[model samples]
Target: MSDHRWSPRSPVAALARFVGVPFDAQTYRNLAYLLLAFPLGIAYFTVVTTGLSTGLGLLVTFAGVPIVLATLVVTLGISSFERRLADHLLDVEVDGDDGGIELAFGSVEEAIGTTKRVLTAPAAWTGLLLVGLKFVYGVVAFTALVTAFAVSATLLAAPALYDAPGVTYTFGPYVVDTLGEAVAGGGLGVLLVLVSLHVTNGVARFGGFLTDALLGGAARSAEAADA
Candidate 1:
């Protein structure tokens, strides 16, 4: 078959191709962004969790829901940061040609106003929802990604590890019982790892769709509303 003919013809194939490609050049850049996403996730998780926790406490201690409101307002800032990061690392353009991010709103007063606007604006709320959704889904992605890597690595290293003297760490229960079992288990693990890559790519695509729904839903609805 021609090189083109051998290329991916389906989503699964595409994901396999993606996994097979060496992390070099533009691919390396994309993978690096994914790697860097963890720290960003940690920062966001801390801020939101802290704000919500403290705010709830204050609301309970005092009265009214001002702390809750404040927490939600702080969330607007977090949402904006998420969008910018997506655009920067994933090259996913989120804004309109003219709507422009409100960089002018740099002061605390302006940020408060922006938060108010974000609260009132359906589009902003939608974007926040998307960010929240992605944040939660990311936990699953990271877990699966790491599990796949670890399982695959351990399985592939079976020959060396299992055959080595005084080595008794089991991989899968069945696979570690004997050398033959190790080979079989390692093969299965490799397959599982390959399958995980497909799942990861699917998750990424779903995340993109979510971004569109939350961020562009307003723009689309606005056009429809106009009509």
Candidate 2:
């Protein structure tokens, strides 16, 4: 006879895994990162778009050179911050060396060299690209989170709010007015909440991968070689 075991494929194991998702600390960290992404992404998008456009628009004049260089420097700084943020919240090891160009005022030659390096570095361009992409990612993440929570909350509270004046609960064509239906809705909400947590964590992992790829010097070099 085959020996019985608590395999992950078993129904009980699958249910336990689903139920435990929300209790994980990493899940909350992912949620916090996603929540912060929306506002931070908007800020990043505004700064990058304004700086790049203004700098490029004035490129015909001598003044445009410094403005564009300054924008690149600022972009590198933002990328550095993103690396640290991902390292902390997403638990990803983003490389410390982001091919940063150090500015030195010791001589005119040094300043010129730094500017050339910053303009040429793969990390700088990739970082700028990452910042631009972040805005889109943030919008999607925020929308998904809000929609998930709103639906889950409504379902979870259906039991108590179904009979309230001017309140009605409808799932598809079925009305959730009876106590049994309300309880069922609450159960569904629980499952939805758990599923949402898993989805959030998955998205966060993708964010971590993106951060590491763009912000890490080694990955940037590899990508450049591949290209």
Candidate 3:
């Protein structure tokens, strides 16, 4: 078997890998995932919070039982979708049997059994937690990515914009006015973009990990059985 460790032959090879992050397909996928996280997170959070609050609030009435069950079913469905999304965009394998819950109208006993199973399932609770926290995760990711890309783009455009009338480009303590200074600022911008791509990849990996842990029902069950 060939060794595939991070044993680059030279400093130049290591630097090439670092600089080549933007060209990688996975990096773009990570960017897409992060970009989508904000809106999707908000949607998930809204649905989950509304369902849970409404269902629990009305639990005194007979309608509350069905509502809560329906909410759990919907949450599980969302979890399944998130798992698939992580698999597609982050290239993470989410392996496990999703305990399928089907409410049978024909038999009350079957319906009650299904309800019990869903209520006691570890996956259900974990999935709920994941959905609830998605809003915060989305906001952080969206803000970070937008800020990083915006700053990088601004710096990269400094070379062309610095000389324009009534325009001043400043990078911290240094002001970009001359062509040489603008060029240097542009170079720094390129470096920042590369760094941002790497950071984005790292963030995507963390998201994938969170999804796998919360949604991998079979894996969790197997570990519990082993214990």
Candidate 4:
């Protein structure tokens, strides 16, 4: 297994190291999980949003606020699903930190009470907010991912076919009247693809940071309790 552990005496350096990249096996696994998990999150958001929006719209009794509430409920389910997915995919040992979940309060009554406490807690709301943000982001990311791939591929390919001396036939909404234009457009497209890669990578890293913040429940709780 690869060791991703880094030595940083200070909090700031430690955070910088964590955010930059994983050098150890664990870090690599976590990063891979994060990358893969996002697409899963996108799919999860799409299915949930589509299904809930359609289903709730069908119900006449469900008004605007009710629909919002229903959506929130679905979002919660998605959050739980993603958490489990992350755990399984990353092989993250949440038990050590007791951050993922805690089964401290035993018995049905105690469990219910503890749940109520968690629900009412500010950290829980922050987690929900994080989920909401991720849902919106996932939807956008999925759209951009498809669009970028399509646009980049088409543009990069256009130079080959359209710029070819023998090939005159052009395609799509783009008007490549001349071979020069086609070749130029392809160059522009290649630049666009580089830009898209940067954007996607930025979004992925930002999403990972947000996930770390919102999903670090034990850390949040401990801090909150300390304060």
Alpha-carbon local distance difference test for all models: 0.59, 0.85, 0.83, 0.57
Q: Cα-based RMSD of the predictions, in order?
A: 5.3, 2.9, 3.1, 9.7
Encode model 3's per-residue lDDT on 1-227: one tens digit a residue: 75545458667778889989978999999999899899989998888788888988998887778888888887777777888889899999886655455657568898888899778766677878887677788899999998998989988999899989887777777788899888887998999999999999999999998888777854577568879
Decide which is better by lDDT, 3 or 4.
3
For 1-227, candidate 4 gives per-residue lDDT tens digits of 73355336666767665444423454444444445655665665566567557756766764544344445445455555545554664443221132344434568787565555445444444545665576676667667777886887877777667756666535466567676887777887877766665566566556655655565664566667879
TM-score quality measure for candidate 1 = 0.64
Top-down TM-score ranking: 3, 2, 1, 4
Model 3: weakest 10-residue lDDT segment is 96-105
Candidate 2 residues 203-226, lDDT tens each? 999988988877786455756687
Q: Could you tell me every candidate's TM-score relative to the true structure?
A: 0.64, 0.88, 0.89, 0.52
Residue pairs in clash, model 4 = 2-25, 3-24, 4-24
Overall local distance difference test of candidate 1 = 0.59
Report residue 201 deviation for candidate 4 (angstroms): 1.2
Clashes of each: 0, 0, 0, 3
Ranking by lDDT: 2, 3, 1, 4
Please list the residue runs of candidate 2 whose C-alpha ends up more than 4 Å from where it truly belongs after superposition. 1-4, 7-11, 171-174, 217-227
